[model samples]
Structure formats: C-alpha cells, structure tokens
Target: MDVNKTYKGVALQEVLTLLQQHENTSKVIAGGTDLIIQLRECKVTPQVLIDVSSLEEIKGIEIIENRVSIGAATTFTQLVNSPFLNNGLEGLKEAAKSVGSPQIRNIATVGGNICNASPAADIIPPLLVLDSELYISDINKSRTISLEKFLIDKGQVDLKTNELLCHIQFNNIKNNQGLGFSKLGLRKSLAIARISVAVWVEVEENTYKQVRIATGACSKLGVREREVEALLLGKPVEEKTMQLGAEALKTQLEKRLAGRKGMEYKREAIQGVFKEALTKATYLSKT
Candidate 1:
C-alpha cells in the first residue's frame, strides 16, 4: 500500500526485464481499475510497479488471415466501437459495452479484465464462446494457450510470475455461424452480472451442426456448459430443442453449485438467460 518505485514510458523489453528481475515483487499496471482497488484494500502490496499502459506491443486490433487479433491493452470502449467486431462478433461487442459504465469502459482494458480473473467478468463468457486463445510472453520465452485453459480459478490464472499476457485471438465465425450474449443483473446499467450466458452456433440445413455455450458468475470460473452444448449439437433448431438445451444447462448449474447459497436462484435464472442467448444466435444465423 505504500508508495515505492514506478516505471513508466518503458518498452515491452524493459517491462519484461523488470518483471523477470523482480519476479513476484513487481506488478504490472494497466488501466488500474482493478489493481488500484486491490492495492487500496491492501490485497496486493508490490514494491515495484511496471506500468504497461502505453506499451506498443499490446495496444491495437488487427485482422490476420481468418483470425482477429486484439492487443492485451485494448480498452472496452475500443472494442465496442470497432467496426470489425460487427462482422459476426456482436456478442463480444455487447459484452464490452456491458461492463461498468462509460468511464470504466474507456479505461478498463481487455487484458486487465482477463487477468483479473473474476468469476463474474462479462467479457469472459463471450471470449470463451469465441474459442479464443491467449498469448503470453516473458523475458525468456512466449507461449499460446486456449483461454479456457488459462483460467485456473477465481482471482487466479496460469500466468507465471514473470509472464505477461500479450494478446488474444480467435477465428472469425463463418457465414453459417452466429454468436449471442445475455446477462442478468440487478439493473440495466452499471450493474454487476448475477448470471450471464453466451452462445455460438453453426447451422446447416436448419439444424445445429455445432454449438458452444459458456456461462459466468455461476461457477468458480466462467466456463463452457458442455452438457448443454452436447444436448443441442446436431439437433434441429426449434423452440422445443432450445427449451431442452436450457434445461440441460440448468441441471449442469445445479451440480456445479450444489450446497452453495443462491443455488436455487441461479438454477432458475440460467433457464431464461440460456434461452435468450440461444434465441439471439439462432435468429442471427438465419438472417
């Protein structure tokens, strides 16, 4: 909590060197929305802060081949306004828009959101449904891993002490595919999500050729509802099928949150959220 050393205007190489040298004692700061709060509460007290807010290596969005690559420091506002996201990635755009408020969106970076690893993070469910992959680097080396595999638990991730998340990339949805997102919160704006769901579907001849469903706030980490996805894959797209898939998700949540407080509410709430997400994706695919 006490003031110490701060490094700024440094390049990526310098940041990595400082991180490698200080290891656990040095913390990276960007946006500072979550880290500032943690520091204020004395949850983390690093002796050195390496500010990566302006690092060029992690600050833009690019389209390479069939994948959309987003820099780690790209803010939520940038995501919401990007024309590229309109091309079948509306779910991600909506998720970025749903975070806190205009001010928060302007400052909160996608990397910060992912690195925070909060179970209720709005962007995680959408990213999971996108089948996103994360790139991580350190002074010594770099690696890539699936977003799902990178998240280990609440407030924790697979990142090493000296590693930094560089960017995220996911393949674009094909012409026959669509994505959707739904969130349940106490209010329409500036409300933390109580339960949220995202759906991605690939349709062929009016049937579900592939289905992916991810949920947030209902588990220790945002996760894919594999049982629900399994139930819907290869099934005809219809109201009845969607209802059944929603029920499958409800059952899965029951098992995942057994004995926890608010379990019943989550089980019941997931039904509507899942249905909404599926309906949106189905509609978009047909259009």
Candidate 2:
C-alpha cells in the first residue's frame, strides 16, 4: 500500500475540501480493513489516502426522530454492543457478529462494508432488508440515496469521484415488526458467506402484513428478493406457508443463477436459509 500522501482528517468540511482537491487521486479510508487490501493488491491505486477515522461527525450511532442513524465510520464491534439495536433489531447485531473474527470486527466499519460493495459481505443483507439510505457528500454538496440504488453492481456503487459516504439511516423497528438474519458460510466467522438471508417483516395475527427479504452471495450484489417477499406477504405464518415461500425463493434463484457453477447448490441452500431467517423474524414479532 504505497501512497504519496496521507491526511488524517480532523473535520468533515476539511475532509471534503481535501477530497475536492485530490478528487481522482484520493480515497477516503476509515477502518481500512478493505481498502488496505485493495491497495496492496493494486485493485485500487489512489495516490493520496484521506483518513477519516477520527472525524467525529461520522463515528457514532444514534436514533434521531425515530430513525436509526449510524455514522459511516462506526465499527462492527460498536454495532454488536449497541443497546439501541436490540428489541426487534437483533438481526443487525447478528450480522455484525458474523463478520470475520473479533480482530476484524474491532475496526471494520459498516460504511466500508457498504462502500466496498462485496457480493458476499456479511453485513449487507441485513442492511438491505432495513431499506437503508446513504448520506453522501463532497466539498459543496450533499445527497441521499437508497442503498439499493446506490449499489450499481459488484464492487461498484453510484458514489462520485469526490463524494464520501457519511452515514446510513433506516427506520426503527416498531411493534409487531422484526428483522432476522441467517448466513451459510464455509467456516463459522471466517469464510465469506455461501448464502445469507435477512428478513424484515410485520406480522399481524400470525399473518405476514409486510415483508422484505434480502440475500447475499446469490447475485452480483446483495439484493432484495421482491418476488419471494410478495409470495410471503399476506400469507399465514405457518410452517407450510413458509416452506412454500422458500420454494418460491428457490425458483427465483434458479432463474437468476441458471448455468452458473453453484446454481444447483444455491437453489437448494436458499430454502433453508430463507426459512431460518423467516422463523426468527416471526418469533421476534411475537415477542
């Protein structure tokens, strides 16, 4: 990771100014868990590195007017220990805990995870189900975009040359609403996900009133499974109904990954993953 210049950012405005000046040559780094590896591998070759690890404006998690806002630089360990993420939002903690080991969790930023846009990122599926939004800024302008739209494709996003992702925001879970996450990895906490699912649902009298499903490692990027969500919505939360929903997801996977090497296995694996995630969501809604 050779860089001609590095700046430790002290303020948001200062960082933006630096980014404007170095637009094409600078990369914003928080935890550097992903960026450093990219740099070493020559996947990215920014001549200047701007360190925003100390920028207070982008380094905490808080609830603002019923919306949960996480500073882009907040670490996975922070997410795991946040009291505000409890109640029906335990799925976020579960996802954060599944990211690598403790050492990696200690510094891996949620913003970094999203910015890297890894198809198998452990944290993305859960965030996708939350319908998260990103706040991005440059020297003179700032904008907000839905996470789904912000993600253009694998290892790519809608971010501009000088813009930085400042934070992520989502609605807080309410009564009868719950979110659940489940991942199938080659090795626990070490290997990337083979498949992962996250479900956010609102249940009423054992029926699914509203449901959103997101999957990782099943496509070019973590994506919402709207077809499966539609299949489960307005349906009774019975084992048989849920099984049918899983079958629907399997069918969707079959079409999406047809002719791919892992298509058959993923088509089968998604059923169990979807069922487990939906089960947790329904149980949380009842509690």
Candidate 3:
C-alpha cells in the first residue's frame, strides 16, 4: 500500500501532466466522497493521486448560448442554489440536494457521482431524463458521450483510465416543460436509492410533445424508457393515458432486469413513482 504523497496543483495542465505520467493506474482525488471509501476498502489502491480540488479549470456552471455546461469539480450545493435551474431544471437541482446529506452535498461533485458509475447513483437518472452529455478528456484525446453511453455497465464506462471526466452539458428547457424526480431509498435522508425515477415533459395545449422518463438503481444502468415515451407522445395526459404510460414503463423495466431478486417490490414501486411524476407534471403544466 503505497500512498505516493498528496500532490496539489493550481492549474489544469499541471494536474493533467501528473495524472498522465503515472501510467493508467492513478486516480484523481476530487471531492473524495466515493474514492476515499473505495481506496480504504482495498478495492482500489493507486500509487499516484493527482488532486484536482484546487484546479480552476473544472469548476462552476455556465450558460453558453443555449447550452448549460456544468464543471466537473462543481459541488452539489452549487447546483442546488443555481438561479437558472431553480425553476427550469428543478428535478436535477432536487436530486443534487437529495444526494447523500448536507455535508456530502457540500463537498460531493457531479463528476464524482458519475465517475462512481453505480446503477443507483442518485444523480444519473435526472441527467438521463435531461439528455445531458458527458465530456471526457485525456491528455492525448478528448470525446463527448451521451449520458446513455457514458455508463456502459454496472461499474464500467467508456471512460478510459487515462481520461478524466470533464463535465456534463445539456440544453435549457422551455417554459412549457414540467419536471419531476422521485427516489426509493431505504430512508429519507443520506440513503442510496434502491430505485430512482426522473420525468420531464413538455405540454403543448393538452397534448404531450417531448417526454423523457428515466429509471435507475433497478436496471443494470440508468436509461430512458422509450416505450413509455412513445405512448405518452402526442397523447393527452388523462386518467387512461397516465395509467397506460405507467404500465408501459413498468413493462420496460421488467424486461431489462428480468430475474432481479427485488423485481416484486421494485416493479410495483417504480410504476407508482412514474405515475405520480406524470400526474404532477400534468398538474403543473395546467397551472
């Protein structure tokens, strides 16, 4: 167990150089919410730790043109207080607030949450529904990945070891859009989600135009329920339509995690959550 000094840097270039020089095994320490736990458990023991906490390059959120770019090192608390998203992206801001606890949110970052790559990651579901894109940067190569492709597996990603996750970017929402988020954790606060659902819908008159619903924790990875979206598209949100949409989403989740041991509880719970989310969104759209 070699802890090769805690090296701190002020610039991104210097951090990148230190990270790249250590072969493909070094881990960058950001908020250290998840990384420190993993390292102490002996699950990961890197010889080099390139601390990026002070690097000014990957911090803060910005609205450039129509796109909303969130820095990799931005804290969850920063997101929870963002005026631009206070109403437009309420679900995302809510999800950030709900992650871990106040203490964790004060330090845990969006990049750290995504990098952990857990199926139940509290933030991934909302980001998926929002259609956020991930920017991954390596010293030699850089690329962008859709939220769907970023989390390739339960604990794996297209992110190469040499690459550092830069940030997540997405477009601003319109006034007609209503957003909702719900999570089934063991408890109310500081609990990891057993299943989480996020829904975003744009209502044109009484009909739904663009709808996005994403489920996490239950599946191998968080993803949008396209089948459910198709049913809700162009359809008026009413008693019958909402029921059908909920059932459709349930069917899709069951198919993905066919033999999951918690299917009995998870399937029933997700349907209820998605239905409530849709109901709330419709109610909000009307007002």
Candidate 4:
C-alpha cells in the first residue's frame, strides 16, 4: 500500500533488470493474492513491486521432450484445467482445486505459492512428490535448483535478492507411476491444511518399485518423508505395508514435533491421510 513504485512487468528480462536495480528493496509479485494481504497487514513494506502476472515467459504449461515445465505465473485455475496434467498427476489438480476459492485460484500463481513458502501451502506437497525443480534467473545469469533444496525454512528460500523464479520443471509421470494427495483442514474450503500428504509410487503387480512421500503443515516446510518412503519402497503393496509406513511416519513426527501440542493429533491423523493418498496413487498406477 505504501510502495515507492510498482511496475506492471511485461517481460522476464525487464523484471530482472528492475530487480537488479532495486536489489533487496524490490519484491516480485505475481497475482498479488498473498502479497497484497501482506502489504495491507504491513507484514512486508517493499520500496518497489515488480508485477510479473502478465509476463508471457512465466504464464503457461508446456512439455519439452520428457520434461514438463510449468510457468511460475500459471494460476491454480490453469493447473486445475490443464490437459497435460491428467491421469497420474491428479494429485496436483486436487491440490490446486483445494486452494482458496474460485476467485483466489483465478489470480493466485503457482510461482507465488512457491515463492511465498507458507508452511501450509496446498500446492507444494504434490510438487515435492514429483521431484520438481526450479528455474531461477537474474540480470546476469540463470540457474536451476531442486525444489527440495530451494526451500530453506518457513518463509525462506534460496532465492537471491535480485533473482526471479521463472518456472517449475519435472519429469513426465510414467504409466507405472502415480501421484495422489489428501489433506485435513478445519473446513472443506477456505481452510489452511492442518495436515496434507502426497504419495508418489511406482508399482508392478503387488510390489512397490519406488515410493516418495511428502507432507505439508507437518514441519517448518513442506518436506519429503524419506524414512517413510524408504519403508514402503521395495515392499509389498498391501495393508500391512501401508500400516508400517504410517507407523514410521508417526514415529518420525513424534521426534520432529516432540514438544508441540499438535504432535499427538498429527501423528494419528497422518495414518488416514497417508492411506487415502496412497490408495489413490495405487489405483492410478494400475490404470
């Protein structure tokens, strides 16, 4: 609300130039759904805002060879309707649909969600299970980093003062691989997730060839549950295996959230959430 300047950015290079000029004083805004609220609350008072909502370079979803690229400016509405995100990637669609309301989804950008780095970010768990990567650019050069590494902490990331996140990239899901997501919130809509889980698995018959699990609102950041994933990988795809994985997750959460009051509830709730996601993932893998 009290910015020295605001630019309606039309080009990626131009946005980078503005960022370089303003340095740490500039904030990159795409879809201002979150930033505007932060501005109003005085949570952030940037001297300049570079709006990239209309930048063509960061506004669509495309496939280049075996990789899928999602522009940072792509809205949740776009993700919900993308033809390329069908079949095994239904988890992403579900996540996108769960974010805010219809109006909020229309303007909120996936890039904005990632950049905002909220602990309860609805879109992150699915992306994490897919092993997504980020493409970052600045005035001088460009670089790519894994989404896992890019996230440093709650409300923190590896981005530099002058860098812009251009797009997210990931390998195309295969017929044998599927991704699923489930979340528990206070209400069905417009409620931040208390617990969210995403499961990605590669299955052949009754065996799991590979497995990846990610959770949101269970820690400082949305993160992969490698220990639980390891417990499920190479194991039989059965109730016993799922139960074991769930127990492993609870044990890990017990340690991670030892002193928190939500620990007991989350440790128990994760079982059902993990089961629902894994059930959907298993069903998709066979289809």
Candidate 5:
C-alpha cells in the first residue's frame, strides 16, 4: 500500500492528542488491516494518521467478575489463543478464526472490524448474539452503547470522528446457556460472509429459558429472528423443535430479503446451519 506519510514510536496519549488537534483531518490506524486496503482502493484519504497499534491499553482480553472485555487493538490470533476467550466466548473465537488469511488475521484489529461496520463482517453476528457493548473514547469523553443500536448502516457506526474504539464487553453465557456461530461464504477461506448466523439458548427444568438468534448478510445488519425465537421459547430441544425453529428462521429471513437475489441459496443453507448449531449447543450444554 502507498501512503503519503507515516507516524511511528508515538505514545498513546500523543496519538489521542494528535487526533484531537487534527480533528477532521485525523484517522487512527491500528494494525492498518482495513485502512491499507481502503487506501489502495482509493476509498478514503485523511490528512493525518495516528498510529496506535502498539498501545498496551488496547491489546488484551480479560474475563473480569461481571463480563468479558477485549481491547480494541486485540488481533485475531490473540483471540484465538486466549484460553478464557476460547473457552467462554467460543462464538467470537470461532468468528475470528473465520476471517481472512493468516497474515490478515495477524494484523486485523477487533476495533477495525467493529468500526468498519461491513454488513458482511464475520464477527458482527456473534457479537450481536452476545448483546455486546462498545466503549468509545476521545480526548474529551467516553460512552457505552449497545451493539444493536451502535451499528448504523453500511460503513457507518456510532463512533465520532475523533473518537477511538477502546474495548468491547459482554457477559458470559449463563451456566445452562448454549451458543453457536457459523458463516457461509463464497469460499471457506478468505471470502467475506454471504450469510452468517449465531444463536444462544438457555435451558432450565427441561424447558427453554432464554434464546437469542442472530442472522447477518441477509439483512442490512445482523438481526434477531424474534418470531422464531418466540416459537422456541418454552419449547423442548428436540429434533422436531429444532427443525421447526430452523425452518421458521428460514422463513423470516426469506421475508426480510424478499426481493433480493441469492435468497434461494441463503434460505436453504441457513436452515441446515442453524439446526446443526442449535442442536450442538443444546447437546453440549447437557454434557
């Protein structure tokens, strides 16, 4: 990638202050994973670049007393190797694994993924199911926002121009909760997702306790299939229920993407994927 300039060996506070100073002209470059590609494609150009890839405050995963918090600068490889994340946030770990080539995964930051806000971004579906929240900071202030309401549209988020993505946090699944993640792409390797789904369910006393089913690529954003969830609530986790839930999810997706091409493939593919995922989650939680 070609660039007019580069900034190195800068402190985190310096970068933040630089962004604050430049304001409209500044863009933070962490890992340069998405920014380089966008620049090469001539998609965007900013007068100033504030590099923060080496900032310690933006680079770890922690499971605190209440929730799991991952720094914005944490890379895919870090998430994949994290025991706490791998064991508890399997859906997120799996989604991170599904990203591009090894080199791309090594350099792509979680903050970039969230900020880029691609409708097809692989991790968004899993995060939506977690009902995650983002912590965004600027020189002046910081705020927390829900995942559902944070992503606005294609290539847009609730982030202010000078603000930075600090971290992402979400509670762990309850003791009896089961979670699963899957993505359908043109190829299993580097392709962007064509359709993705993540589901979580909690069972107690042989009955459905709570459920969150999220689907991406079909909608303008990742979405919860509420009608199907309504059907699954209090329903037994049997083959019949799985089939019904999956089929209903398919129907809802079809209705949502009514006029779009590729609906046929997405509708059929999602049913099988959702069923397999929900079944595995339910079974694994029992074991």
Candidate 6:
C-alpha cells in the first residue's frame, strides 16, 4: 500500500481534525511500537498517519481529589518511575515494570497497550482492578467508558475509527485498601506473560471487606474474576481463605477456556498467580 500523508507535531485538536478528514483511512501513532509492527506485517494499511506521541494533552500523570488521571500517551517507563505510583498504586507500577524491556517500556504508551487489546497486555488487569475509565474523544464529541467495557475482544476495542483515547482515570485506594499484581512469563525478561493476576482488597480488622480480582492471558480477554471476588469478600484474610479463592479463580478460568489448547496449563498456573497477588495485597493492606 502507499501512504498518502504523515502528520507529526500535531496537537490533539489537529489530530482529531485529520482523523475526521481521513476517517477509516487514517491511523493514530503514539509510540508506534505496536503500530509499526502491524504496518510491517501488512496487518493495517492506512493512507494517513497522525502522530500524537508528543501532544501536551496526553503526556503526564495528574492527581486530583483522591483520583489519578494518566494521560493516554504516558509511557510505561514514566509510570514505573512516577513517585505517585510508588505507594497505593504499586500494582500498576509492577504491571508497567513487567512490560517488555527498557527500550520497549520507554516507547510503548499505555493507550497503545489498551487499544491493542491484547489479552496478555500486562497493564489491563491492574487497571481493571482499579475500575479505571478511559476518556475517548473525537472531533464531534467525547465520552468516558470503563476500561473493562472499552475492551471488546482480543485485538479489538470499543473505539471508533475517528476517536482517540485521551486519558485513563481511577480512584486512589485508601489506607485500608491495597492493590497487588503478579505475572508468570516464560522467561524473566522480555517475555510475554503466560498468566497474570491483579488483586485489590479492602481489609477491616482482619476481614476482607471488599475484593476485586482481574486476570490476563488466561482467557480471550483479560477479565475480572467476579466469582472469586465474591467468594473472598467478607472472609478473613488467611491462608485457607486465599487458597479457596484461588481455587474458585481456577474453576472460572477452566470454564471460560474449556477445550482450548494450553487450558490445562493455564488453569494450573493461575493458582500461583492468584496466590501471589492476594498475598501481596493483603500484606500491603496491613501496612
């Protein structure tokens, strides 16, 4: 295919204008890590490329009134190094750090990762546990949708061709709550995750008051383990309770991925992933 035009150094407004003009023929590029690969493999052939990587509208992290808003273009390296993410949002930090290598982390934006909608994308599970919402904007209008809802299927998302993902926001966990993430990959470095879990827990005097669990790479789309979360809610935060919760998560995974290749291995691997995430979340809550 042939490229009709490439626009760089454009602001968000101009980018939207170009997208409106080109419609389906236009593609946005931010940190081009994934888009470049798709282009090279002939998976996508856009006549126009709008580079929004440096747009000031989507390049930083902000905290306001107990909520954190991350610009869609924020890189994994930026997330990993943010001081604000060091405390209550450690799960997100861990997930960002677990991405690829330093080079990929530096170049890959969170929006790109989410828009790619890869089941194995490390950032999605943690964001899901946080109940994150994405802000999508187009020339005509703007709207917000939950990250879970925004992700339609593997390699697909609920985004219009002319829309851009602007920001991701989630409430900050309170002192009584903690978030934790764990992933098992084939290799330690530069490896795609085989199984990953993110857990958020609220503890009240040794009992689990509220719980949210999300898993990645174990299903067609990264999803919250609502059954496991319900089973763990109001239960004591102890070894037995955690073990039971893990088992429930395994059952959910088995049901969702039945008869698929590698289902058996993923079902078994989820136990460890859930355990690690739960243990860390519990430990963090206590502190």
Task: Give lDDT tens digits, candidate 5, residues 1-287.
Answer: 33455565245666667667777776778878788788778787776677878888878899888798988888888988887763435677778999998998898888888888888887788888788999888877889998888889877888777787888999876667767787777887998888888888788876777777888787877677788888999987778888889789888878877888888888899988787667656754554
> Which ten-residue region of model 2 has the weakest summed lDDT?
83-92
For each candidate in turn, the TM-score is 0.97, 0.98, 0.94, 0.98, 0.93, 0.98
TM-score winner between 1 and 3, please give it.
1
RMSD values for the candidates in order, in angstroms, are 1.1, 1.0, 1.6, 1.0, 2.1, 1.0
Per-residue lDDT of 4-60 in model 3, one digit per residue for the tens?
767786887677677678756688888999999988898889888877777677888
Candidate 4 local lDDT, 207-243, one digit each (tens): 9998999999999999999988888888998999989
How badly does each model clash, as a count of residue pairs? 0, 0, 0, 0, 0, 0
Candidate 1 RMSD to the real structure: 1.1
Task: Show model 6 residue runs off by greater than 4 Å.
Answer: none
Candidate 3 total steric clashes: 0
lDDT of 6 at 283: 82
Kindly indicate the candidate among 2 and 4 with the higher lDDT: 4
TM-score of 1: 0.97
As a whole number from 0 to 100, the lDDT of residue 94 in candidate 5 is 79
Residue 58, candidate 1: Cα error in Å is 0.8
Worst 10 residues of 4 by lDDT: 83-92
Which pairs, if any, clash in model 2? none
Candidate 5 Cα outliers beyond 4 Å, as residue runs: 1-3, 9-11, 86-88
Better structure of 4 and 6 per lDDT: 4
Of the candidates numbered 4 and 5, which has the greater lDDT value?
4
- Residue ranges of candidate 4 with Cα displaced over 4 Å: none
* Candidate 2, 1-287: lDDT as tens digits: 46899999999999999999999898989889889998889999999999998889998899998899999999999999988776799888999999988998998999999999999988889999999999999989899999999998999999988999999999999889999999999887677899999999999988999999999999999999998888888999898888988999999999999999999999999999988999998888888
